[model samples]
Target chain A: MTRSPFTNPYVLILPGFLLSAFIILWPLFQLGNISLSEVNRFGQIRGFAGFENYLAVFNDPDFYGALWRTLIWTFGIVIGSIGTALPIAIVLHEDFYGRGLARVIIMLPWAVSLTMTAIVWRWALSGESGMLNSALMGLGLIDTNIQWLAQSSTAFPMQILIGILVTVPFTVTIFLGGLSSIPDDLYEAARLEGANPFQLFARITLPLIRPFLNIAIVLNTIYVFNSFPIIWATTQGGPANSTDILVTYLYKLGFRFGKLGEASALSIMMFALLLFFTLIYVVLAMRGEKE
Target chain B: MKRTWLLSVAGAALLSLNATAQADTLRVTVAEYSSKTGPYFEEAATAFEAANPETDVQIEVVPWDVLLQKLTTDISGGANADLSIIGTRWLIDFVDQGIAAPFDSYMSDEFNDRFFPTFLSPSVMDDKTYGLPIAASARAMYYNKDLFEQAGISQVPNTWEDLAAAAEKIAALGDDVYGYGMQGKEIETDVYFYYAFWAYGGNLIDADGTSGLDSEAGYQAAKLYKSMIDGGLTQPGVTSNTREDVQNLFKRGKVGMMITAPFLSSQIATEAPELSYGVAAIPEGPSGARGTYGVTDSMIMFENSEVKETAWKFLDMLFEAEWRSKFTGGEGFLPVNKAVAAEPAFADNADLKAFAAVLPDARFAPVIPGWEEIAAATSDALQTIYLGDGEVEATLDGAAEKIDRILGN
Candidate 1:
């Protein structure tokens, strides 16, 4: 049947398209405009200052260090979360006793607020009174207290560890959903062909869940890239800017330093990088559709 | 025809909503000025409401970091409080933005004459009073009596040499205790150290607001802090110790001395009431200036407020001797007005008296436009020295370059 133009799915999607344009695209455009000019705390706009703000950001070592830390933050969290979550999901998918309780336990981190979790984790990770150090000390594993969040060398990994803890629950939930959707018949047929557990998982389980993994990867990347609370609560990107990520740097630039133009520029750059990674993920996923 | 009727109805509804939303109320936002669950806003609202029966005064209190975020969002969105108690260092940047109202016209001779002019000076930009100083705090030395007594110290250290000697003596107490605590975490800790450096004859910035932290005097102050840590008189964690960490140790009676504000005495009273302690002027640098960090909360009016007159009335009431003493007492802050300082409430306490005595010689942190930036860089450089990883002179030079870069020199 030939659908009327107004009744077509694409045509019906127009309102959503316009709403996204208004809510999302419009502010992005405004941010871009502000990045090229000067707007002080008073909201008064100035003529274009060319690339002075961006230049200033690039010239500062702290900003550069934060940018490097941001890259480490994004990949460390993304890879770490996905890397560990898939195996846990696989194990949990197998029929076993107390699987329901295990699933509930795995998902608990996702139910808590990020800020609340960050605060609790911060206390648990403190150098002096933290639960982790105290336990280690009681175990007689180390003689001295380790300033985990206070040292630059340890602060980044400490942040990543917290990121992974938070990210694991959400990623596991996603993986569980993906695992349930896989057709049981594929596994049965592979078994009929005398396929072992490893072969079944590698050939059948992996390919069928590729789309879900892509979604998980993309969402986790975006979430971790912009994650602020963990770093803010743990060290506030300190022990001397060692744990600073792009979002925190953007915050410091706009608020702490009152350099809104430069901060907006950094925001634009972050957006561009996110967009690039997302596009690559989407393209790869779409190519997989042909396979 | 039907769409037009719907649009007309929506417009009418919005106009009615807007009228009620724009009430004659003064809204104020404060950043983490109150303790958790403290009656900061409610008390101020009650007092402010009582003073002005016709006007409604509301206050919104938030965590300092969140408060800064909210303020930044509001200012960038062209929405802000009519009057807010903002940090003194933040006043200049907001002044440059042109949204801040200068209190020159609002300042009464009596009010202006009360505060240490230098304390209020940070709130001044281009010779205009953009804000009225409300609550002020300064960083001074706090020594633990038990630790001092244990070290066989008969008297609290009054000079740099004496302080160091005391630290060495107390370091003998072993793992659970340390002789002294100096902030080295970064940012504010560095600010604390700079005050010490300047007290010793070192200066972070020259008179023209240029970097001079690499000078010989600056090196001496930096080396002293580094040496104290190296000599085992400070906790190994001092390199990462923030105010809270230091406070924790002091509360546990683990540290002999700490450099902090009058607030430390209150902490001691609340956490370890049995602990004996005393407050003193920060030991003078070789220059003989008693350097310590000075913090002030000032009120600024938004330029676009329709009720600025009413806002000024509330602001004046906020600074009144009686009202200010009550407000500051609740928050553990010092009154900006000299009249309030003379009240028996603050005068009754010996520790409060010592804290107040230094106000005459105390100075605010560098009041440059890029003070926060310089504060972070200098603090980071100081941390490098505190960690015993770098030369004092070279670290200061690096900090100077970073500060100059920030200032666009």
Candidate 2:
């Protein structure tokens, strides 16, 4: 009584399914449960609290502000990085001198740890004695130094800028890979048919790389949506909660404030938002694939 | 051969059991000292183990910022240490959660009386002591003598007006030098605000347990800070500077005054010996009263500690006169024990004496649940005010309302 491999596809995927269930589903279920109940500081579940946690989150102005900021942070970084990366990737895709070295240099920010990048950028952008301030002052661009991370008006923009800077390298690599995967014969045929560079790009290049572009946008959106260390290390979502995004606020609620139930509700909200974006992306990708 | 091997295996197991039965190991965790090796905890452990040869003391040092998270994780995972040093404010939370054991049974009244009542109050809830204060610190004004001389100020400022005048004089010296370095960021933001708020006779909570930041003193404190920033007595972009950044500015002789703790004295001694400075009680406010913030850390025993007696013995050893003096002196912290306070090592030091003078006047933040969130709210309000985002009165009022809500009022 030997069993064939096709006897059960579920069994074939059993290990991966279990791993995902343990790593992802269990904590998520626990989070959902905790979100719906009242929890004390010691992680004890105190009876069910209905939709109280969710109501508290919805009623809180900070949560609303953070949700808006989280959207701005996510889209700003995702679009900024990919938009910048496409040009750099196109440039890098050319047969130029020192292309390998250039590629590595551009990818260095992605290689370095996010925390290190944040700390370095923090020092560089510091108010009184930062390198950026010093350079700006020396260059006579401004008479006074700007407190980049300290002022609300500047902090969020600076965070987004730093987020894009660190995000661009990886995005560039993805775009470069996508560019490389496009058959050069198509471009050669287009050029022979007297198609200009714009036509070559609009028709052959983009269509061919549509799958990679979808992946780049969707993954970047998710990554930037959940980014924490950069914002936490830089501002801790402050100057007045001006730079706070959803994840940092969730951390403050859960760990700092010990409002685990509310924090869990916020986490579920963030999860749903990201999930919504992911579903839309998946559907669009599938439709494009069918076409 | 199999029987012989089995007998040898059993003999080995018995030998291991005998080894385990010989000595008891008490695990302890302490907040990190300035040094990476945590010499204070190491020395205490060595001395404790020396006294009790039959017991082994295993000590772990964790940084203050991560201590609570680590302890909570350990407690949840059922791997907590026998004893650990925690912030005094956290004592109530730990006791309420049943994570910390009441020390009243292990401690005598005389032993408990050894600590200053102000320092010991936070460790007690409902008249049951749960921890013992090991180290304490209070904020004080530090002035750069060189800058003071350059500004032609002969004495440390005694009143808030005089301090402002001195700041003006210091700023008059020009060349990128500022008079006062305000900490407008992070943890110290609200603390700096409190220093002024208390100086002006403001309180966070009133006798009736209501938000007190809407009082006149609160408005005065905010106005004073705003005036200092707007009058050009403080550096541009003061809102960007943290306590450490401001201290560094003072150390570089670029700033004239800062209100910080005794820790800065040692930092200056090590980092900027060339800079001459003097420590004084913070300037009196318009109310003619001086006040500063104080913070304390306590050593607490866990409820589930298996070696409770051994752990208490080790803690008792740490509180002995000689060991207590050594620990406090080594860490540059104010002593919790009165006898340790009278020791020549602390009394003879100029900086320590200055801080000690203000010890009685120092006030601790209210030890209650949700105080962290309250502090953060206050810090946010202060930051907003400092950055000129909102009116001082409006900001303070908004913060008070928010805090009242947080306090469930």
Query: Per-prediction DockQ, in order?
Result: 0.49, 0.57
Candidate 2, B192: how far from true, in Å?
A: 0.8
Candidate 1 lDDT over residue span A1-291, tens digit each = 877889988789999999999999999998888888977654456788778878877877678888888888899999999999999999999999999999999989889999889889778877778898899999999878887776778778877988999999999889989999998998999899999999998998888888889999999999999999988877777765667888987877787777788888888989998999899989988987987
lDDT of 2 by residue, B1-409 (tens): 9999999999999989867765678898888867833877777788777878888788888887678777866875688899999888777778878889988888977787677787888788888888888888998999999899988999899988899999999999995899988988787688898888888998889887878898999999899989999999997777778888898899888999999989898788888998999999998887687788888888899999888988888877788778878777767788888888887777789998898889888888787788888989999999889888999999999999998988888
What's the CA error at residue A284 for candidate 1, in Å? 2.2
* Candidate 1 residue pairs in backbone clash: B199-B285, B200-B285, B200-B286
User: RMSD in angstroms, all models?
Assistant: 2.9, 3.0
Scored against the true structure, residue B63 in model 1 reaches a CA lDDT of 76
- The stretch of ten residues in a row with the least summed lDDT in candidate 1 chain B is B32-41
Tens-digit lDDT string for candidate 2 (A1-291):
888877788888999999999999999999999899988775668889999999999998999899899888998998898889888999999999999999889988877899899988888988878998899899999988787887868888888999999999888878888999998999999899999999998998788878888889999998899999888888888888988999999988887787889988988988998999899989989997998
The residue-by-residue lDDT of candidate 1 on B1-409, one tens digit each, is 9999999999999988766764468888766655731375667678777766667877877676566567778877767888776778777777776778877887778878877676678788788888777778887788888788888999888788788999999989787688887666744787767666777776667776678787777788788888898888887767667877788888888888888877777767777999888888888755566677778877788887878888887777667777777776766777677787788888787888887788776667666677877787877787777766678888889888888877777
Question: Which runs in model 1 stand beyond 4 Å of their true positions?
Answer: A1-5, A8-11, A41-43, B1-23, B36-38, B50-53, B110-118
- DockQ for model 1 equals 0.49
**Top model by DockQ, which number?**
2
